[model samples]
Target: MSRTILEVTDLRKDYRQRRGLVSMLTGQGRVIPAVDGVSFYLRENETVGLVGESGCGKTTIGRTVLRLTDASSGRIVFDGRDITTLSRAELRPLRREMQMIFQDLDAGLNPEMRVRDILREALTVHERPSDAEIAGRVRELLEQVSLKDSKLANFPSELSGGEKRRVGIARVLAVRPRLIVADEPTSALDISIQAQVVNLLRDLQKNLGLTYLFISHDLPVVELVSQKVAVMYLGRIVEMGLAERIAHQPRHPYTGILWSSLADKQTTEVTRRVTNVAVERERRTWGVFDFEQPTSGCRFAPRCPLYKEKGRPAICTDPASEPQLRDVGHGHVVACHFA
Candidate 1:
């Protein structure tokens, strides 16, 4: 197997609302727990999909991992180096190896700069490139993202939404980053354009050997490109397993509901098949998890459909010890109390 390129352990980031004079006087200051103890791994050339609803900490996790936003706590190990505490000067050289594709293309790109200038600036930031070399690299990066190098001379306004994002990607690729923190790469794209970008990313991963932390709320899109999938809810990964396995059999309720799009195969099948699958689980045990530093018994208890009167799931585990990810064969690792 390829070496692990990125490993995040108990990563957490909190966005706080500073108390205004009025709120501070009234004592209403609150810190939004955006990313609370989310963890996963991204191997070389592997795509790990992070899916959750808006405000579930998916994008915050991506931004924090790449250091676009400083993390509140937890370790971020990349390429065998701990970057969480590296000073600005120390982190400068390593910046070239890690890149990000922003959710808002125009927001990240300078409106004052043309496409060529945008790509060229990235090259200049890292080192002094000859004019000819800079121009050639710009053209190459544009082609890598399936855009004409001629578009390089155009302004951001001259391109479509998809094309603008492609340019943003081109600028990042121009730096030859080994790991990409892609924040909703296709969110602004139309359905047809979404597929094109997804396919382009898949192809680029194979060619460049790039590992990705693909952040999105769309389950189907995440399923298409990721080898492993982690479901996040209110800043915690409630379920994590192989993409295909988790798609087929989700051990967590949040996972089951969020997974309907990608893993609804058994769910949409004949009623008998679904009954047998759900009933067959009675013979086995599953693991369980309780989010630390919360105000309730289970964060999902408020919305869970199968939750019982006494606060236990109808078809779930209640293990007393911390759960371990165990293979149910076929590379599926479920973190439930019963398993």
Candidate 2:
């Protein structure tokens, strides 16, 4: 049995949006839950992919896991210890165990700093090593990330997109983190470069026994790296299971639409159905104003093709009858009523 290294229970992150001049004067703002009641666990040395559309709170979930942003309310347990309420002083030591790889290397890396300086600084912050050890460690990290020593003196601007990302990965590894929250690490790279980075990450995991919470909007990349997959929609997980099962035989309608949208051929019956639904809607874009925001019930029901095909069932719209995740079989869970 795999040991659970990280567990998130009923995690929620809400942002208070400024209403307007009128509401501001009235002292009222709306609370928007970016992540609402999400729960999952990651096993040691395993990769769990959190896949969702752009604005489905995937990135927020990562940030909250690392405590980069404060969660509204939830339990974040790391290594069997509750970290949700840990003070800054208490969390300082635990910081070395968790790290995050950002989606944009430009934003993550300090453009003003050279690669050597960046790596050296990260190492110094966590622990004190002798000068000789620091130098040897730097070389080892560069070799581990497959970057040449020549790039050490180069600034972020001087490196290619792929090289910058490699540097980002190297910096993360310098801390010897046990769990890495990789948020779309290859989204900015070319297709060929993306594959190289993905392979590098996989190899590193095998060699180092690292656990990863890989977050991405790209279905194929997620499938390539993940053993398990979670599909989120509108701040909630709609489906989750083994990576192959979720990819080829998704139980939720939203997952089907996402799979069909990325399909190379619409030959299968399910693919045909998803393709039709895709055509009906213009294109899925993330924003509060894109579709009617559901106050309750199934949040995806407003845009779900199955809900429409079923003549807009009352259960879908009723606020009192919120759907909970149920196991279909073999640990495959879906939140859909019709699934």
Candidate 3:
């Protein structure tokens, strides 16, 4: 079995919201739990897809795990080393081992610098490679990401969206990172370009033995790239299992609803059946709820179809009975009272 490369335990990241100057002065603010007690692991060279609706903390979890953002509480272990409390100096050396692929096409690309200069800066961040070494590595990175050497002279502003994305990826690769947190890497691209980038990512993973925490709302792409899929709702993972099982045999109602929502966009017979089974009981309006004033039990209870189908069970609403993840079978885990 491959060694576990990253392990996160009960990770929680909270943001405080103060309504007015009075509240701010008085130090009174509502705490919003962006990532609430999330836990998962990634094996070496494996991809684990984190899928959910917008604002469900998929990106927050990705950032927190990389220590790009600090966690409010919980442990983050990378390569069997606990890095949750590492200072900036201590983390500097580890930075080369991990990196992020941001959602923005021009995230790390400097508008003032040409593509080659940008890559050179990244390559020299942790080491002082000689000019000859830098030249060789630059060519290697361009080949690895399938970028033309001629484009290296163009600034980020002069490049197309796809080219900018490729340059951003090349910059990350310059550091020779083993773990990458890809935050919606393909969401900003055109359909044809999206397919190309997806294929490129898969190829790079296979050739370089990279591990990825792939975060995206595109269910089909996530299923295609990930070995395991974790379904998140209201900042919590309600269901997680093998990608195939999570797609075809979801135990949690939220998981079924997520996949079925994708079915609405595509007219496949298999997805149609999934849509019918998942949303047939979904009659309640999905009202907006304040994160600060969370529901008593399950955070997803307000929108959960199963809660209504089960005749509004009191345990689901009981303050002391919020469901926790429990193993079902075959490594599948769900956090539903009736799953």
lDDT of 3 at 114: 94
Count: clashes, candidate 1: 13
- Ordered from best to worst lDDT, the candidate numbers read 3, 2, 1
Clashes of each: 13, 0, 0
* Candidate 1 vs candidate 2, lDDT winner: 2
Tell me the tens digit of each residue's lDDT in model 3 across 69-182.
999999999999999999999999999999999999989888999998999999999999999999999999999889999999999999988888899999999999999999
Candidate 3 regions with alpha-carbon error over 4 angstroms: 19-27, 275-278, 281-285, 288-293
Kindly list the per-residue Cα lDDT of model 1 for residues 104-152, writing each as its tens digit: 8686688888988888888888889899998788777877999986787
- Model 2 weakest 10-residue run by lDDT: 283-292
Per-residue CA lDDT of model 2 for 74-126, tens digit only, reads: 99999999999898999999998999999887865888899999999988997
Score candidate 2 by TM-score against the native: 0.92
C-alpha root-mean-square deviation, candidate 2: 3.1
Preferred candidate (TM-score higher): 2 or 3: 3
With candidate 1 superimposed using the best TM-score fit, by how many Å does residue 189's alpha carbon deviate from the native?
0.7
After superposing candidate 1 on the true structure, give the runs of residues whose Cα lies further than 4 Å from its correct spot.
Answer: 20-26, 261-294, 309-335
The clash tally of candidate 2 reads 0
